[model samples]
Target: MQKLKDRVAIITGGAQGIGAAYARAMAAEGARVAIADILDGTSLAKEIEAAGGRAMAVQVNVADETSVLAMAEAVNEHFGRIDILVNNAAVYASLQLKPFSEIDVAEWDKVMAVNVRGPFVCAKAVVPFMRSNGYGRIVNISSGTPFKGTPNLLHYVTSKGAILALSRALAREVGGDGICVNTLAPGLVLSEGVIQNTDMREKLTGPVLASRAIKRDQTPEDLIEPLLFLASDACAFMTGETLVVDGGSVMH
Candidate 1:
């Protein structure tokens, strides 16, 4: 069954990495996907359309309220309705792995702005349209590092922790409007960015694999099913929840 048939989904950071994977999977499942990102998503959107799916690429800076609101308006104008929002944009790929005290405050603030405020802005911008349609799905992308208190990336971890709380609180505020909100926390996924950075990949995935019950590399593809379930009508009754997809690393 096409779980997302006729749905319109906006995947922030959908130009590459795990967000791109989500855009593709959602498009395959019959959703009209909008690949919104700071980077150009034109090619990916064209790829989806070429493969018999409906998609559009929009440039957006999730951290900026004006940009987010403009993105929501553009998407709504094109698709006629907004059904799902996948908050996947963050400042992780270029993050410097440094000790807590060594990390600069400006860098910390940047991470917070993108990783935390970005989702908040996106939700606020998309809510009115979702309320108008009488249904919506919001899936915020978080990281498992916060749960494990992973070191060397304090700002990144801290920002992700806020995402879980954000998802919970936002869910409560929007549940009455028929909008279900949840968080999808993934482990060390060997996405395009990670795979391209061999040193970073080895440094992160080594600890993850050692702790994981399933001893294999986690990929962006591994997250597709959970994302789909959250975005589908099947999850209407579920909200304010966090699903940690980390191969049994953190059992909580």
Candidate 2:
């Protein structure tokens, strides 16, 4: 039997890249997936449906509380309940890599809004539903950068670190309600966004691979199972944990 049968999952930033992969995987596991993103995920939703999976596209700015509330309502209205939330939306793709001292205040604020506040807003909007239903799984997407103290991406790293903290605290608060909150920190994945960033690809690829004990490129496919496990009943006893999926690069 499918792990997520009859479940309804909301995957933020699901239009493309890792988020898209999550949506597809969850849908395949028998969940009704809601693809929420600032960009249009209509085509991806259609593709999931074409592949005999259940899905819907919701255009949303995760940083906006109003948008997040509406997204939660829409998912609830369509699926009757929200069983899982993958807080995967963030402002990473178009980030301009530069020294911390050189980074603009505005740029830092934008990163915080999306990478940190986005999850905060999403959790606030969705938690009540989960609480009311007495079951929910929240998987916040963090990063491995913070573990390595990765350079030239202070804002991104700091924002992801905040996610880790949020999950830990939120897990404690919601455990009584049968809700679980955990963070998934992925390493330098060779995602579409990463691959398309010619500068980033050229600059960090070699060092990233060599640093990993696996010594191979990490892809979105590599993360699907871990994601599913956290979102499934199999992880019912687990919460307030950070699962690092960084190819053994940062073991702690």
Candidate 3:
């Protein structure tokens, strides 16, 4: 059965990498997906439609309230309802790993804007639509690095930690309205973006693999089922929960 049959889902950063994986997974489950991203996602949307799944691409800077609001409007207009939101847009692969002291102030703010404020603005833009429908699912993408206290990327780790707090607080505020907010924390996966960054892939992969109980590289496919559960009716009774899917690395 199609878990998300007829549901409308908005996936930020859907143009590439893990976000693209989420888009494909949701589309395959019968959701009409809106691929929202600062990058061009038109090709991916076309690809999904060609595969008999419904999708549309919309350009959006998740950190900008106006841009995010416009994106929500576009999706609502095209799909007629907003059922789920995957807050997956972030600044990670592009970052050059460095000690906290060496991190530039401007870079730190940029990371916070996209990693933290992005989700906040996105949720703000879409909540009214979800509230009107009396139903919604918000899956905020966080990371396992924060729990492990991973160094050399303090800003990235801190922003991901904020997502946990954001999910819980938002879940509490929206629970009565039948809106579910949760966090999905994934370990380092060799996504398209990560693969292109040789520094990130080469430096972190071996150590991350050693840390995992599974003792294998995590893939985008590894996250599909967990994402489906959170975005579908299967997770109706659950909110404010952090479902970590990092191959049992950080058993939180």
User: Candidate 3: where are CA atoms >4 Å away?
Assistant: none
Q: Count backbone clashes in candidate 2.
A: 0
Compared with the true structure, the alpha-carbon lDDT of candidate 3 equals 0.96
Cα lDDT tens digits, model 1, 1-252, are 899999999999999999999999999999999999999999999999999999999999999999999999999999999999999999887775778999998999999999999999999999999999899999999989888999999999999999999999999999999999999999988888777776677688778899999999998989999999999998989999999998999888
lDDT (C-alpha, whole model) for all candidates: 0.94, 0.93, 0.96
lDDT of 2: 0.93
From the highest lDDT down, the ranking of the candidates is 3, 1, 2
TM-scores of the candidates are 0.98, 0.98, 0.99
TM-score of candidate 1 on Cα atoms, chains taken together = 0.98
**Per-residue lDDT of 54-131 in model 2, one digit per residue for the tens?**
999999998899999999999999999999999999888677678999989999999999999999999999999999
TM-score of 2: 0.98
Error of 2 at 67 (Å): 0.7
Tens-place lDDT per residue, model 3, 70-181, is 9999999999999999999999999988999999999999999999999999999999999999999999999999899998999999999999999999999999999999
Q: Could you tell me the lDDT of residue 252 within candidate 2?
A: 82
What is the lDDT for 240 in model 1?
94
